[model samples]
Target: MKREMKEQLRQVFDTPDTRRKEEFLQNFNYPKATYREFLFRQIGYIRKRVWGLSLVLILSAFAVCKIMKDNDATYSMVWVISSLFPLLALLASTEIARSSSFRMSELEMTTRFNLGEVLLMRMGILGLTNAFVFGIVLFSVAFKINYGCLQLGLYLSVPYLISCLGSLILMNKISSREVVYCCAGVSCFVSVFNGILANSKPMIYSDKFVFFWIVLFILLCIAIVNQGSKLIKKTEALQWN
Candidate 1:
């Protein structure tokens, strides 16, 4: 009797729609495969674009190194920090919006893994790429420039978080592709503004405000991650409405 009940349940789920729904629930995975393929694809995309990022960093580093070698002034470090990071932030923002840049949104949305998981995974990939670049710049600065770790860190962190967090928030008001341009523009503006401020007033952030920026960074990260899930759901739900 139990065997007969099992057979009936199997037959009920034998239809094409049920199978597709099950596959979707399994996150675009075959019974034998995992999401590693998806991850690798994202890695390759970053690798393909590595040249642009490298050029920006290399040129800035060369200029900074040449200028510093000529003079012992510590103020040169301010210009280096200000110039490189905001452009990196702009590039990172473009990476975050790659899906929209390619017009692959509808296809990505309906995949077996669905839009939410794909978005979260892609953003994770971009984050790692940015981290790699960040580390390189920090290492170079440590050897070549005379700046406090906290000061350089705040320069990178503040612009990066501002661009990413601002992009996520703008999704409500603009198309994702448009948000990329908006983020890039804002980052450019910030880069110039920061450059001016850094030169005029080196080390704008004091030791007392260090804890405040740290807390703000943590909150922004949490908000960005949480919004990924919400954005995906909202995107899909809009189709039905």
Candidate 2:
């Protein structure tokens, strides 16, 4: 009975003949994930702490903005909001630099998605997420304060951009886990500097120096792009090596 049962099972589940196998292989349609699909999938894989901390920052800023509105502390609102921008950069830079942070570049390179591609996707996703958060925070504060979109945008963006610029430069220079901590320190320093400027040179945010902020913003944007390109090239080099 056992022998008969084995024979029956073997007959039902027999390996395909060579001719059939060849035909099947020829006609096979391997499903490929589109860029959008892959991107959305990667979003889910991001650490929950990133999203949580971002939410915490947003809520904290809104709460402060509310209190500042009640107290009529307009400049204080900008100072509080702008200071938090570095923390956003820290979240993003840490995630992007995580590959090198833990010496996972070699293992990541061996995966289906190469290390550079993975890093690029992560950077793009985290960047867009952070930008959206920034926009919401910036506009919310702008609506309540006496500041225009351009003025508030520059006030908020310059510090965040500066942090990003510093982070990318540090990432390019250092490849160890310590780079993550250094990026954190850079962000903290930027935040502290914002406090100093708000306290000492509030005139910098005045209309007369708006042009100065604009020029600084443009320069930082250029520097960030240049550094980001270098970092990507370095990651690609690591993949080949």
For this target, which candidate reaches the highest TM-score against the unseen true structure?
2
Off by over 4 Å in 2: 1-33
> Where does model 1 exceed 4 Å of error?
1-33, 203-216, 226-233, 236-241
lDDT of 1: 0.67
Q: What is the alpha-carbon lDDT for the whole of candidate 2? A: 0.90
lDDT per residue as tens, model 1, 1-241: 9999999999987766445776686686444426897777656766455547656775676667667767975466646565667677666666656667668777766554666676667668767767787777666666665547765666556766766666666654566467777877777777777677767876565566667768877887798776665666656653421
Q: Alpha-carbon error at 174 in model 1, in Å? A: 1.3
Candidates in order, TM-scores: namely 0.72, 0.85
Give a tens-digit lDDT track for model 2, residues 1-241.
Answer: 9999999999999997566778897688865667787788779878999999999999999999989999999898898889999999999999998888878788878765677788889989998999899888988888898889998999999999999999999999999999999999999999999999888988988999999999999999999989988888887777842
- The pairs that clash in candidate 1 are none
lDDT of each: 0.67, 0.90
Error of 1 at 24 (Å): 15
Which 10 consecutive positions of candidate 2 have the poorest summed lDDT? 232-241
